[model samples]
Target: MIRTLIFLASLFFINICSAEESKPVTLNVIKTSITVDGKKSEVYDIVQDNGQEGYEGVKGQNFDVLLKNKTNVPVAIHWHGLILPNNQDGVAYITQLPIPPGKSQHYFFPLVQSGTYWMHSHYKLFEQQLMSAPLIINNPNDLYPNYKSITVMLQDFSFTSPDKIFANLKKSSKEKMASMHMDHDMNMSEPDLNDVDYDAFLANRHTLSKPEIIQVSARQKIRLRVINASAATNFWVNTGKLEGALIAVDGNNIKPIKNHKFQVAIAQRLDILLSIPNKKGTYPILAQVEGTKKQTGILLVTPDTKIVLPSKLATSDAPALNDDQERQIHPLNSVVTKPVTKTLHYTLEGNMSDYVWTINKEIWPHVTPLKISKGDQVEMVYTNNSGMSHPMHLHGHVFQVTRIDGKPITNGPLHDTILVMPHSSKTIVFNADNPGIWPMHCHVLYHMEAGMMTTTNYTNYPAPSFYTKMISPQK
Candidate 1:
């Protein structure tokens, strides 16, 4: 009887293993070739969606990400606007080492937020092309009478490689990396690229005329996830044929705002839900950058055979608010928004020519730590002292972008990355729910390597098991 029991138990365990193996799975791996621009190029690196669970409720979609280069370069990838484990945030030399060229760095993080958010390289100009689609996690519980979802990713491209662009900016001598929050002259080169292989702006790898359109049915709720994936450009999203309701920002729920079109700064994400009012054969969702050309990602759905379009997108492109509106919107909200409080502040500062960046004007020492209690509501402000835009971000946390230039978010949306325009400012507020000392810095990777890097601490929280997975372990 004992022998029979053992045999049955072993047989049952094997069957369970077989069943588990049969379940659907996804994977991200390093590959050498991927299709881009209708041609198969020798991609430097590729990441397959190792279809590991990316977030809490996200259904698996294996993203075959295109990494630029002949091979993996020493790169770091941090989901700047995500709540993730410390080891996966992709902070280099501190959390992990750089992923070398001609190679691929595979990363997975729980996609807890369902709205709009993005991913980018944590190193130099790599974000220009190497950065792929913004991973959108949809709410499984959200049966909001909508069957269609659209993703619009915005990006900045140059005729020349980013390597050439940076080198040229450096040669100009007048071009300097300003303090992280300081102001600098915004005089940019005329965007017209000569000898450009890809002279087009893209909304999901396609230009406006040849737009990326998605089809939705009439009278159905269509959720559009807008991601400003650009390295430099800020965008204004135009909703055509669909008058949308602003439902959420940065994957966080907010009171819906009634608006037709809105401005989205670099690195920010907006989630808009719209009802396809009767009559839509084919229409386009366009993203036009101020003072530049436009790109389109299409949503082509049919309840009828009528082509629907708004008279003019700019008809609804309200001018950005002046100082008065800023004040009315972002009222002086309380700092350390805690029923119980723990206070901390680091003054973001920088120098142009020196290319030196600082927190409270001091470069962060690799040995020290940033401190905070778990579950504390943390607020950080970037006061612009120079004349340039800096997209400031925090790892392992997504904060509420509350104010711009001390004004509150009255009607405007919130985002993970708030572009601090030259000499102006923005303040972000959020709860530090996860416990880890995470890095906080500029999303412009080169600026970070220069000096604009720092960390925040959640006291008494040990590092994650993934950190133990580091190949070149530190003592």
Candidate 2:
């Protein structure tokens, strides 16, 4: 009888421990304001643990996200680059309904992978109001344990509302096409690189005029995680007077390469390692927007150094991005040779004349999903027929760029997002290990809002009831 009682006691203890492990992390989506360059502007931010700025967790742990909405409008949070379950992907209409105004929802998923990632509002235009933050997951065996780390989130801010800006862009594009005697059909011509001019660029929520200063000792090793969260801007990151080794892109580690400057497209991330000079002085790490004179950056200062803001950087023309650097990056682990079971071809089609973007000439509601079987090796070829670049991002999966323009890449780096250049083709390969419906779309905000999106689905897998009710059948 005593042994039976002890066994029951042990079972009770185990259940208690499980309950503790399954507790959720509460995050509040808030309406707030921050001062940039000495000017105040209203914005949105995510807060946790009594207003802590960001979220962090160790690898292999379960994350239950309780998103409390404090704003008056609906919002949903997308766990960018996280290979979580599809139900937690946070697309408003596709995954689940948007969190209504002043309401909350729970998103629970397991952290199956470890790396640098971020989260932002998936709702329309809310991410432009500064509704993003870093979502970093740490591995126990860190590669660079001795190096101090810093996160620089790059953004483009304007006083104008994002809706109005998009409307104006559509109007201007129509006018410009009419003046040039061009057809209104979007398929006839390519779109321009940038449509809207922003008022300011920011690094770590501060402008160049009021940059965030990092204190460091001379000869210290530093790891800088740079995230380009801009809605429509690409940036060329320059580490002034400091030679940096490019270690990772989009949170995936690669063989380190020495570089003075690198380009980061919208919704991308770059991890750079720098060995500070032995001499005591201040150095600026600048992110210059492509094609414009505007720039923003942060300063790394040593002891007894006076911080002096540098003048705005100048470029004669817009910087161009190439696959040369991307080609150099390879997976840290050797890829196993496997037979590809299926191949899919897609064309990115869009033009600024009508401000409508599509995948394979069909918008989201009318588009057909790319279907794959679980555990099958899949290869997808994206041919960018559009004029502007499209940084295509896939949810709940990481893919390797296996071919570019019909040539095979020996060992490419794994990424959740890849930028397909205008009129170029990119081929990516991945194993369909996770089963669910996932949205694949361009990371550019306006383009996505205009219908540059699609879904990947596992054959015969059932979607959630909420999704079925929310999204009407396209056919």
Candidate 3:
């Protein structure tokens, strides 16, 4: 009788432990407004239970996301660059249904990897209004003891609606095409790329007019975690006059390489380490929008130094985007050479005249998914035949860049996003270890909205309930 009582007590204790392990960190998605550069615009931001806008989790903990939508419209959240389960991916209509107005949903997933990541709204154009924030997962054992870390989330803000901006772009593209035919000698060397003209560029939700100042000590080492959270803008990040080493890209550690400037496309992240100068002074770190003179920046100042904002800094031309910086990165831990079992070729086709984009001439929901078996090493080759560049992003996995335009790149670093130049091609290889349906699409928000999205599916896995319901005929 005593043994029976002891066994029952042990079972009760196990149940209590299980309950504790399953508890989730609550995150509320609410609408708020902040004035930036004299403009007050409404935004959707994710706030934690502590009433803070940002939150962090451990490497192996379960993050129970309670998405409480406060707005009148439906919303969904996508955890960018995270390798979670398929059902917890937070994609609207693909992974799960949208969280309705004044409702809540639970997103439970284990944090399988440790890195710098982010979460943003997956609804139409909601991400443009600053509905995103940093979701950092740290490694406790691998902490940098003496260095200070800072996160910079760069974005572009516009007062106009995204639908109207898209319409105007279509009209302008039609006019340009007609003019090109009439005037044969029109120099089309540098074609217009970006669609929308932003009212202001921001660094950490503030403009250069009132930039965020970082307090620093002379000769101290600083680690900057930079994320390009813009919906449709690319920037050239310049660490002005401070030589830094690029240590990681897209949350994966790389062989450190010294660089002064680097191109960060949409949805990309860069981890750079900087050594402050011994002489105390202020320094400006700038992110210049590609193909435009407008820019935004942040200042690092010592305790005794006075802040000096630079005038006419954005008028000067910034460097063009290229693969020179990408070629220098190599993964810290080398991936074992595996035999390729499958090869999928996708062509990125788009035209600004109609604002339509496609992958292999098909749009999402009508496109064929790239299928592979579990444990298969696959190669995805993206050929961009469009007039503009496309930063291709793959969810749920990091792939090594194997080739560029038919040339092999030795010891390429693992990346979640890689920029394919206009009329060029890029090749990446990854093992299909994570068994789930993953979206592989262009990082550009409008481009993906217009149609350039598809999925990678493991063979024979049943479609989730959300997807099955989406494809069912309306009653």
Candidate 4:
């Protein structure tokens, strides 16, 4: 009887593993229409066959991203914040080819980490068209059955085509230069913000006038995953009337910091946990546009609470985001120090006159590759000399912000993206355990499109056949 029971248990375990390996989540890439200001505008989305938005899965499981491209144009989806194999980093022409129209591509990998992450297009200007969604991988060990989980994705929308917007920026460079000269002559040093004025800011595809309402129970603990998927805008996430604790940033757990508001830059994600008030009331989690009065967010309402519409704009302008909040963040786990094996320095250089952004004064496709070796500890220091703030993101790795403005930080939080302010410097450190050429660039879409991207290539590493014929993005 004991022998039979052992054989049955082994068979059951094999069956469970087989089931996990066989089931793949299918994300259909299709063009859809969204209502904006009484008009219907076309947008792209990655959804399930049943029209379910985004994806959620368990950590420590085998999963596959079966992307089916139904749109006419080619698409490449980047799994932001996931540290997977280098060949799976989905930059078009760098790691792999774009998925052709009507074709499908499968990405199979192990879910090594769990937290709030996102997926979006790495193709040309597709991200600005709303081709993004939350990619949440829940930690199996976190058995928080009492908490309610919610995701809020913030975006900046424009009625104008992205191509036209790029053209306009190029055409108006001279006017921008003249304005910069005037400001300098007057001795003004305020950093510039909001390069492109968007038609609307959206929270989960809804404006403040018609915000997404999330029903909640009184005294319930809520875990909110907020993603800043905006092309260029930065926002201050305000937890109105309710105190919340920021538990994570960029999908990595950090020491809990209690705050009412936090700044989230483009491509950054924040995970906050808060409890609803015992008395029934409507509370808003608002994202105020940085440097402007515009706001967008969702409402958390209890049963029987009336929904009150919010104004599209705020009463006062929000100040530009700084690094004060970042300095307060520390990793949840004790950081283990490693000896530095390699150090790299880069200067974030650009000018408003030509609207051309570059790393170390060289643009993408022309920039020299930074060399690294596997198993080495790498330290990268970036000095932002330009007048614009940049959120730099590195693919296929999570890094720790070790220094800010030349000051050392003992145990900074780990992040895939870090925001660097104008004339400020930041230093990040990571281990080069994953060997492959990976792109690291500014998260601001226009800046990247204008040539602010470069790659870190491993010394003596072999490149895939497709990588040899790299397609240069138009400058």
Residue-level lDDT tens digits of model 3 in 1-475: 9999999999999999999767766788888887887888887788887887765888878777777887788988899888888788888878888999989998778787666778888778788888888888787765454568788889888888777776776678788878878999997654566777888888888888889899999998988888899988889988988987888888888878887887888898988889998998998888998887778978889898878886425767765577887788898764436988899999999765566788888866676687888889999999999878888988888789988898999988788888888899999999888888788888888888888888888898777876655432212
Clashes of each: 51, 0, 0, 0
Instruction: Show where candidate 4 strays beyond 4 Å.
Output: 1-21, 143-145, 178-191, 334-336, 471-475
lDDT of model 1 at position 471: 20
Better of 1 and 3 by lDDT: 3
- lDDT for 178 in candidate 2 is 76
Candidate 4: tens digits of C-alpha lDDT, residues 235-335: 99999899989988998888789999998989999989999989999999999999999999999999998888778888999999998888899977633
Q: Residue by residue across 397-465, what tens digits does model 2's lDDT show?
A: 888889988899888878888889888999998889888888888988888888788888899888777
Candidate 2: residue 437 lDDT (0-100) = 89
lDDT by residue for model 1 over 133-156, one digit each (tens)?
465666777645445666777665
The TM-scores of all predictions, comma-separated, are: 0.70, 0.91, 0.91, 0.93
Best by TM-score: 4
Candidate 2 overall Cα lDDT vs. reference?
Answer: 0.84
Worst 10 residues of 1 by lDDT: 189-198
Pairs in steric clash, model 3:
none
- Better model by lDDT: candidate 1 vs candidate 4: 4
Residue 177, candidate 2: Cα error in Å is: 1.7
* Error of model 2, residue 84, in angstroms: 0.8
